[model samples]
Target: MRFYPYKLACLLAFGCFVSVTWIKSIPSDEGSTVMPDLQILYKRLLVAEELGGQVSQDLSSILEQLRNLSKTGNDTYLYSVHNRTGFKVSVVLGIPTVKRDKQSYLVNTLSSLLFSLTSSQCQDLLIIVFVAETNLDYVNSVAETIMKNFPKEVQSGLLEVISPSQYYYPDFTSLKETFGDSKERVKWRTKQNLDFSFLMLYAQDKGTFYVQLEDDVVAKSGYYDEMKAYATNEASKPWLYLEFSQLGFIGKLFRTRDLPMIAEFFLMFHRDKPIDWLLDHILWVKVCNPEKDDKHCTEQKALLKQRYKPSLFQHVGLHSSLPGKLQHLKDKDFGKQTLYKAHNNPPAEVSSTLKHYQTHSLKSAYEGRDFFWAITPLQGDYILFNFSQPVYTSGYLFRSGNIETNGDKFFNTTVEVLPSSVLARHKVAIPHYRESGNGFIIVGEFVNGLAEGKIEAALQPVSALRLVVHSDSDVWALLSEILIKV
Candidate 1:
């Protein structure tokens, strides 16, 4: 072994020999908090600097192996080494090495230690090995040493190795053909490393959801539970592009069908753009077509409009530079408090009638009793509504002491009052009202008797009246469209 004196001297100067202790088990329940033994492993590596020569190399090799294992196969073993009972302790070790150190000798010693630990732990785990420069001959030698040192139960089929070569590679000719420029080449290569690692892990594991993490990020408390909930929700929908971390641009929950189209689009127009810019273009430009087979395109557009129409949540803005900022704002509290409120206060009296609406209530008299509202037919349109008033306030407008609709019972667009507005007498203007159209509008007052009623307003042809109502809690107002007009 050709020992580099400078490396040896540096290792000797730093005190390296250290004992590592860790917890032995992973938390099994949802919402249970568990920290991996990374802190202990880091401490061990820090101390290994003082061990000098072979011992230092051994520690470095072990650390490298652990990192590699995370990216390897499905059966990668995770353990915590502990000196106590009822609680298992898992141990991890790392050794650092320069490019021109005695790599083979270091690998052999680390492999021997891992074999010993695995035998004692009596747990089968996936082993990960990482190295700067990897050759099959040296890797095989390390594997052979581990197998020879440990029992078959501990060593058999328990190791996985991941190297830079596996993650980074020569350019893919197919990708090159699709994206010809060198800048695109670089971007694709970066994407390849990220995407392929995830794909490989997903392919290898039988776990319901695959979680891919970058090296610099640390898991937060309850991260696993949060991820589980997110995965479960995502599984119910047909999302194709799911991002775990914020990409500094528009982060989206994409429909699965749209993924291939997006990928193709990227190949054509975004091969050379920065990652964030590429993502923005994909979200803003490429994915907005309503004619796509996947309904998510339409759904996303609507969601985007609902969320980002104003610069309310910086992340929800059409031109928002900050993605995911809306997530921090509760839907109800979004514009209530701030130096500048993003959402405007509701109008005191909205005179709009329901061109079309659906309340699912058979008795028109009960409309004031039940809750109802309206949303825009177009994606991302604002929801408009009036305050909920008591039925007594609306009774003054009805003729037969109760509000009534003719034969169009199943999908009638009836207007109702909230329970709170029993004393106020207000007149509202019906804007753009017509009669020879598809939708109907109703306006009535509920007093001692249902009276002062009108129902002549008509909607555009092919459009039906959607349900309309008012809300009272936050800001008092008028007008609401609860359902889409067909």
Candidate 2:
């Protein structure tokens, strides 16, 4: 039987580990106090070493990994950043990605993480995308896609893109096939272990806690808040890591202080087994007794890893990153996400030409209780919201499709408004207004499943609003959010 190095396990088992609180007090501009992560001090220490001091052991190991890759006078890592927002945060979410043979889910995964995050939450969190590939073209493509889709996040320092140097990966053609895995499988798992180690090392000093995530998963809204609350509440416990998602290595959270040990363990036996199996061995090394019964060992190992209820992430990618592999893993505990957002819309008579799906009626959506889902819409199909009386409107927002049903959205749809003033309603020939045949002026249109705009003063005192579908939709349409500012 093959096991990880006994020396590594013995070192961790007998090492003197220092425990510290995750939060540190920082002074605010208004003389109030804010709780930032204490790991900021660790980052400062690393900076000091650059000035003239001994590099820490953890950093030394990271340098060794890069050095072993045949140094050709290239930098160890590349970064895509607008500005370094170096402020301390509560959590660092690390995503390691490689070139997939099939469709890529990285963008959708990012959208789910970025959705519903408040400004304060954005400031408190950092999402690092580690493109674990040696190919420069693929890495650059990933960076460009992220920048194009998440410009605000990249500029605000909420997100970052990084890749190891082109020379960082070792030649895997010679890796010995182990555990009945094909040579390709051995190479894949071995590289995965290395990728995880590099990401963990890079994030160790960046936050109080670090979360491991894949590039093909959807996150629950408010995941950051839930994770912080749960971890802080369990700070007194002796758990080694907290599990936010039960599938694979998707949502495992660890303290920054423990990252060095974890990364070292993974690097020690990276080629021997899969990354998940290596993680399990770490738990066994820390707690299991050699002479104890198997059940006793299992119980003891369970104490070091905590599992959170109702997993906050779900795997949605069917094509695995590995070539020709399919992944259909789902988290049963994730339950269901909120499909619609309720808003206090003004009183209106809701009706639609399109057939409603089941009980999801337009009136229910207008009343701020449920979403509106309709069968495939044909050209000229329309949803009308006629107010009881003309009202001054400030703005309007219509968001289609929920997180889960992202594909079911109204396509080629226009948002038109009917004015109460007879003169304005009759001004169809005005160059600024594109009037629909039903006395409504086109104001906006759904682009990428969202339509939002401020209602111009000229269009105030609107009597009604309408969504006109101009083309037949391929799939059913769902209206998840409908907001009318009065």
Candidate 3:
């Protein structure tokens, strides 16, 4: 098996990783604490010399499999991340999923991950998806979906799917009495931990770092690079894991060496507590052994950890995975939304209202709040993204107001991409997007209060992008979010 040494995974701008000063502007002063991912290239690169020149055969097999994935289309097993990632195979993003619900978010999440990776960071990582279903029939069905949607990634070895057997779980009969009132909830929670333990064990052979993720989280562009930069720079800090997210256990980066003990803790108290609480207890036991107060235990654990200010991941799941459990979460948009480079602060004057906007306000429109209120409507109002220079943009994404919260706010919403200088020179119009009488090209139109449909055609060399209301009404027009993909 051939092992390739890895460079530091911190490529920021196109050519090379930009200086920490890459973020130049922001869209809002109030709201979620959005800050640049405080990353600087590491002084000490994880080179073969740091690992004493050779790696374990298990890690060797894992890297070889990833390398060969592109050629042979094979999969390899792996486990936890290491305390420090120096040169050796470092991170394996582990996703443990159950098919309790048919509307799976794995494909969307996988697509985001694929789109977010920089060229250099591609080889430094692998994503392992665990179809942790006890039922073989259901497992096979889920596997088929993954194969159908991401055949290329699967064939190239970027993704691997696995299902651990039921026999791998530890017996929990003794702990049944612990869940006096919430038996079903305890059972569900305990099984999730057991599944996580099995996933760690199964994939432990792959790399030194393991990132925990849910099946339904979408990430900001360049998330992997930011995560790698954080992991690389935080090696010297007294930290347990670099938390790339604040929602649930989606983006916690764990060390491979910690998995055996974590899995053991889960097995010992599977029916006693939730996985997140159990993790805190495990850390407390290491620090203040035999600790009692919940506050002290939690604080002690917090002291040893660090989390990114603006999280890298967001939970997009609305429905619950289990019965009687609610799982709706608002999405946080960071990345370029903070810089406001494309003019997101106070959009040009629109219809009647200029200010007093909170939900569906101009600022809120671009706050990266996925599914959050977009700019509401007023009479004759239009929101425009006036860039400093005309940019070549192909597509745009816009979701309507939450259906339950009056999707009627999306009635007659329109997306327009003005032709660029290049297009002006050629005098060519997009086949579907005809030049409207108002001197703008209309690329997309939504009748209902939803951007929830097939994507429209791409717009090229656009100097500006705008959204307008075709209907004149006093009702609020709520936008979920918008993306101008170049």
Candidate 4:
């Protein structure tokens, strides 16, 4: 669509002119610089044919509409009528330890454009600019200069700068606990930096939604509005606002009321994984099952079958070349086949220090098909369910209870036939499988007694067996001699 050049100039007392050009092709200062007539400005930029590029169609259109309003000499009325339905967004600027000029430019441009567009809507909005502990002084200086140079409408409480530590600052303990060791300090720091800034503004601002903008992202025209519309439309559903790019990560968005639930979910599931991985997991799995009940697997499987109908999301690889595109494959092409081709070498030998149990008694009772027992002990203080087979697709460990010496039923359990020749190797370990060249590993907690203790799968015409362990925890188990029936 049509792209418009935005130029902001700062005039010094010495008659020296400092101009910042938001767009590359457009000159910063042109003509007498009499506040650049909004009417002529709109005419030159807002032709339907001019709005053909993807870069700034939304900005051009909004500007064009404002130009038309000004041209009609109704500027006073248009300015007086408030437009607050649009989404109010803000960017929290963290200190830049290593200055990347390009990133800074992008951040400035996005902030400028976002502020400019929202202003045109005449909506009551607030943009809280935050600087973090790392480069607080530098960011503060930059924000001060920018604020002083900002258009009057933007400067009048519409765009405000605040320090992250001033409000909603998370302590070191919480940061360490949320992100683990100092090894991933940068990522954790960045997240905290943004988290505090966004949350602080969100708590004080009265708005339909709060948009979190990073310092390095470039926004297309209408980006904020589009996001706002999406948030509004999908507010009823368990939806998240995601920017799918090469990064393949989804950004967080929710009603003000859902913040706690969203935060709790993030904390529980995103302990060790990257933010994007966690988002992908949620989008791919949890969003559809907000309750995260144990039955999600079957529901998800049926949903996928119905939704995808005949295809999978490309080949079953963790990093697919085509991210937004989803494809389906035949049973043979499914990624589960790769599970059978386990890493021939086992993970570190199971720790002998932990207590172990024998399955010989149970094996003798069920002698027909090839039998295999996969056991995963509970972690720290958590006990596990003792079950042999996976009864549902949602990865919950269900114990058959027969393995317990007392024969006391631990929990009521159900069983569903393996839908696509896929089997659960360990009860608690996150499920790992390959479908049509796509490989994925899930993150889950598995415990013994409450865990799926053992299961039997029929492998016909098989001469050798391969076991693949995908858990971060070492697979510790006792295996009997391979039993083959002719």
Most accurate candidate by lDDT: 2
Kindly list the per-residue Cα lDDT of model 1 for residues 1-486, writing each as its tens digit: 110100112122112221111122212346755446786556555545343344435444533443355444333332111111222112111121112221223333232223212133434223333332235455444434534443342234333222333322323343433344464445444443333222222122222333222211222222233434564555665344455344232222333234334433333332245444554555556457756655767656443321221111112212111221122322222233111101222222233323224652212222333322322222212222343321122111211100111111112123432222212212223453322212223343222111234333121111111233222222122221122111
Name model 3 segments beyond 4 Å from true: 1-88, 170-181, 289-299, 330-486
What TM-score would candidate 2 get against the native? 0.68
User: Best candidate, TM-score-wise?
Assistant: 2
Over all chains combined, what TM-score does candidate 1 have?
0.25
Q: Decide which is better by lDDT, 3 or 4.
A: 3
lDDT of 3 by residue, 319-428 (tens): 66766666777545333322111213323232223332354455445545333343446545566777556666556665553323332355666766566554462343
lDDT (Cα atoms) of all candidates against the true structure: 0.30, 0.79, 0.58, 0.32
Q: What TM-score against the true fold does each predicted structure earn?
A: 0.25, 0.68, 0.52, 0.34
Q: Which digits, one per residue and each the tens of the lDDT, describe model 2 over residues 326-436? A: 988999999998878889988898888989889999999888889899999999999999999998999888988777777788889999999998887776665766887
